[model samples]
Target: MNTEPEQVSLNDLAGLPSMATLVLTVNNRHARRILADLSAMLDAQRQVMALPDIMPVSAWLRQAGDQWSFASDNGLAAHTVDAFGALSLWRQVIIEAETDHALLDVGNAASLAQEADRLLSEWQLEVPPALQTDEYRRFMVWRKAYRQRLHDMDAEDGVLGFERVYQAIVDGKLHFDFQNLVLVGFNEYSPRLRGVIDALRAQGVAIFALQPSQVDAAQVERVQAADPDTEWRLAARWAQSCLRANPEGRYAIVAARLENDVALAHRVLREALGADGTAPAVPYNIAVARPLADWPLVRAALCWLRVLRAFLLHGRCEPSLAGAALLSGGCAAHVVEAPAGEQMWLT
Candidate 1:
């Protein structure tokens, strides 16, 4: 038996069999890009066929968990909660604790605590005793309450969910339909994840890690710019040239620190692509994500809802002048208008 990592190109995905499973990058966006690249490559090769089971790691894990839950005899699925549900429970625990003392930023605190709990489980680390810091003590209390709450609800978070699925697979309670599994763009795996993969391999499943081929030295180029703005401008120009050279070809311009500089990069790219002032759609897309509440429309909607709730509860909407202005700007009609030093009452 030969033991060597499989070397596969993006073009190789075009030849994957229907029964094969392909696990892509951990990031959904990166997985989508890989899929798009594979599609384009297959399209260029004139191969029109159904692709195999392809998904990101997160998606694949969720699918595996669902499959395990469905195949298991016990009703373990009903007791499992996703990440969001787990975070909601953590927030509830923190809120309950806040009744005793004031806590700064409950949402952020819950998120951090949830992440710490996940990391502890992932790394198989025990909570260290003798944490003398005030914050650590508080976190310990909150964690105790949170665990009690989970016990009361008979719910397990994602970390425990993964472990349960792993055990199910080991005990032959879980089975996958695919005989062959291909992992792509994965650098490392946590112990629990590795255990599950090992269990699958033990069950006569063929697992292969697809190693990316190296790029030729002549084909690679490095550019040094004076500043970030210059760097983005150059990138935009390069992308524009690539599109001009091959109008039918797909391309992506990756920017460093894109979340911080999306607006500047967008402006530069639009200008470079000659779509700055035009009403026509832009040729490229930026993939930076923002919080839902960060969007102006969402903020306005939430503010209006809050105002309405206030009005219904106390027969008055007591939104600040700034909030009133935001409401007016978002809606066609002003819901609450507060003038200078004036109390506006609604009945």
Candidate 2:
């Protein structure tokens, strides 16, 4: 996904999220590659979260195999230990094995968890009481297992993987380890993706927003059919989501939709990125979209995630891993940050 040989300094205004703090990514390999490669590049004092589930820091250790790291939720390591248990060897090994076997950075809510209730409840969705207990049990098991790994790691690392990654990248927030926090799942930006973006901003971390390329041109046409105001709102919502996620960092979002109206595209994007960090903006960038005619090629992408998921459970990844790796490039992104000066170190 990182095309350039040297570090790709993404100076793109439209592609980067303005005044945001964390970059919530979905692609597994790029996330891993970025995290691992950047970990050393970042100020050691700051936190650089290596998503154990995503491409993790442990992946680089030849001798460590799948037992060197731990998986914490929301980058909060202590809570995970409290919820799961003190020593979770099985959970620790699984998280490590899954990462070693394959590198996936996305957090898919639908299939990842055994019990749907735990996730839905977190989303603030109402679940049937009858199902809550069952889901709660499943959630408890998963949470407990998840925490077991955290208890094994350095306690200060935090429980959220998103936080860990963000802490690693920011310039000013560099003091302790890049409180690399991992914001779990794309759902965070789905329906209320805008709200999610806003929320990340509130967190105050480095933001990396990604723009996805269009898998279907028809979808773009449908989007164009909506009123300009509605379109602007949608764009604004999209931008807000990224801004919120990465208040201090940069973010990348792919406007993968296709259309010829460059002017309208600009207006839509401006509305999305907003003006001041708070919100309020105009046309920002030329909303460039990526288009492909190959149906199979496109369909394969939608399924690329499954390949990563499979690799997580089993060790061998599909041949599709090559193509799946490119999805991030197909999109655009926005970034925000403080002036980078001295390397930061955490207390």
Candidate 3:
């Protein structure tokens, strides 16, 4: 481990070229595409899987859940792993859910689980039993089987995946030629990524971490009143200010959390900042979350599918709901000529 103080400024690396390579997690791949048209990407998710124990608890749950339909005790809903901190949080949530199951033993179960987790941590092991019961036995059985399959998949994909980048760094095959690496709007970095960054810094590569500027506390509360998720809003406002400050400036939302927030913030800020409510909309460079069902094509396809299925199964058309699904696209388009050719029906 390097003992030197972490270089906080890009200027520290003297004589290094000012041009930088932006590194990002796989979720932000879209944003990176916007920023660097030609820059190569190593999927950080793939790379992080090099550590088998840390190989995303979500993946484990998916595999295990598929094999045995072990529903969570409290119906723990599935969610997207968009943020870095979510992995550990999800693991804890799953364990807690397992502990809460009625089938699991209740007598000193929590204390036993904590002790088991502490022992596993001390021994550098991955398995953490949540209860001393038959359910725990069943879970371990499934986990052992699932882990083998997961490991096999990791082996097949490991070579070309992000894991290669970390391996190259470890093997002294990966080295940066540039002097500066400026991370823009990255809130968190994985341990492997941090290691790679440290290695680059050790070799005189100046790293500068850039974050979105925050509004004052008074402004923050006011903005939160309008929209509770202030992180994206403040970012949107900053972007709006940037464009206003410099007409040529550009803004990119990289791996933004809560996809809805990105669009909402953009619309709100753009209208507020634009003069006479007629300014150009916020430039969202990356693909943000918008509902696919909202699209005309998707809606039409869904409507047609639903109508055809209904007619085939029930031998009748539910016009009220089906008509709504069709919207302006007339029933004529959906109607298919019957086999007799004398009559037509929605097929």
- TM-scores for candidates 1 onward, in order: 0.70, 0.24, 0.35
| Positional deviation of residue 141's Cα in model 1 after best superposition, in angstroms | 3.7
**Of the candidates shown, which would achieve the greatest lDDT relative to the real structure?**
1
Candidate 1 lDDT: 0.72
Ordering by lDDT: 1, 3, 2
User: Which regions of candidate 3 fall more than 4 Å away from where they truly are?
Assistant: 1-16, 19-127, 130-160, 202-206, 211-347
Model 1 agreement with the true structure over 1-347: per-residue lDDT tens digits: 54333666655555667566665566776677666776766555577767776778767777777776665374573487777678767977897788978776776898999998878666666545774678777877888899888778888788777667667877777877787677777677777667667788878777777666565755678899998889989998898878777877988877668889988987998788874453333477788888886787777775676577667656886557346545445776543443422444332
Per-residue CA lDDT of candidate 2, range 1-347, in tens?
A: 43111211322311233232233344555565445544554475655433222332223211121122332222333433322232223334435545544425323321244234234433446557677785356555555555454455645222233234333323222222222223422423432333333344344533333332224644342345266557656755766676667656554434445364555556565655657766554333444554552454564554554566567767777565534534322322211211121122121
- Which 10-residue window in model 1 sums to the lowest lDDT? 338-347
Give the better candidate number (2 or 3) by TM-score. Answer: 3
RMSD of 3: 15.2
Q: By TM-score, how accurate is candidate 2?
A: 0.24
Q: Residue 213 CA error for candidate 2 (Å)?
A: 3.1
Against the reference, the lDDT scores of all candidates come to: 0.72, 0.40, 0.45
> Is candidate 1 or 3 superior in lDDT?
1
Any runs in candidate 2 off by more than 4 Å, and if so which? 1-24, 29-128, 133-196, 203-210, 215-347
